[model samples]
Target: MKKNKTMVEIWQDVVEIKDLIRSIILSFIFTFGVYLFVSPNNKAKELFFGLVGAVMGFVITNVFIKPKRIIIFDKNKIKE
Candidate 1:
């Protein structure tokens, strides 16, 4: 039997389950790693660092993964 690819629509955008899971795992690892490795004495510091790590992960995913789009141009739609 052939397996079908799973896709979900989020905010009117389509996303693959595999990609979503991978992104989640990467973000979780980065967020926790930074939070735990940094000084544990201050709660505020840890929270701030964790947020930074999450942002870093977001950037990493955006940089590494690209969105798929097929854009078509219609001459009739163009106004000169």
Candidate 2:
């Protein structure tokens, strides 16, 4: 008999730690860039919102983004 897999089980394989980390880092960089452009005069506000942006970025990417899959098809093969 085969066992049924739950949604969580299926998703566990799809979610990756590296991707999460990358997303968080990217968010930090983006937030910093925006901060520089906006020139927030308060250091406390900058630090606090940067942290928030990082966490939000991680969660959003993890929940909504999936790794891309690449597939190659060859049409030149001949059947004997």
Candidate 3:
């Protein structure tokens, strides 16, 4: 018989460090793209905005997008 898994267990087992790192890197690139487009006026403002963008990007990607992708990937992996 097979054991049923909880959401927490599935996430813990499926999400990997490499995936997290990849997400972070992708997020950074996205943040950098925004920074380039905006062209902030002052050095301080630029730095602050860049940092904020990077953090927001990381959080959004890590908290939301990554898990969804991981869940889909895990489901496919299990099916294979």
Candidate 4:
């Protein structure tokens, strides 16, 4: 037997995955910068800052910025 998902569930999962990946990538980038800036004095503080920065960056990108394009295809244009 196979399980079925509703449209809402499918979309929710997609959004969740997108946000998780985005946060991780952003966090890494932020961590790198923090490591450079504060590694000499406070390593732990740098890590804390990096995590905060990542969350802020992800929220800003996801909520304030709009994506440039959406991938929609025209069926009639397909070559059969």
**Best candidate according to lDDT:** 1
lDDT of 1 at 62: 73
What's model 4's lDDT at 43? 64
Clashes of each: 0, 0, 0, 0
What lDDT tens digits, residue by residue, belong to model 3 across residues 24-79? Answer: 68788868866776647888878777877787788778675445343233444454
User: Which ranges in model 1 have alpha carbons more than 4 Å from their true place?
Assistant: 1-4, 68-80
Better of 1 and 4 by lDDT: 1
TM-score of 1: 0.71
- Tens digits of lDDT, candidate 1, 1-80: 23675778887788777778878888888888888886376889889999988988888877765564467886786668
Q: What is the lDDT of candidate 4?
A: 0.57
Clashing pairs in 1: none
Q: Give the TM-score of candidate 2.
A: 0.38
Candidate 1 Cα lDDT to native:
0.78
**Considering TM-score, which of the candidate structures 2 and 4 is the better prediction for this target?**
2
Candidate-wise lDDT, in order: 0.78, 0.60, 0.64, 0.57
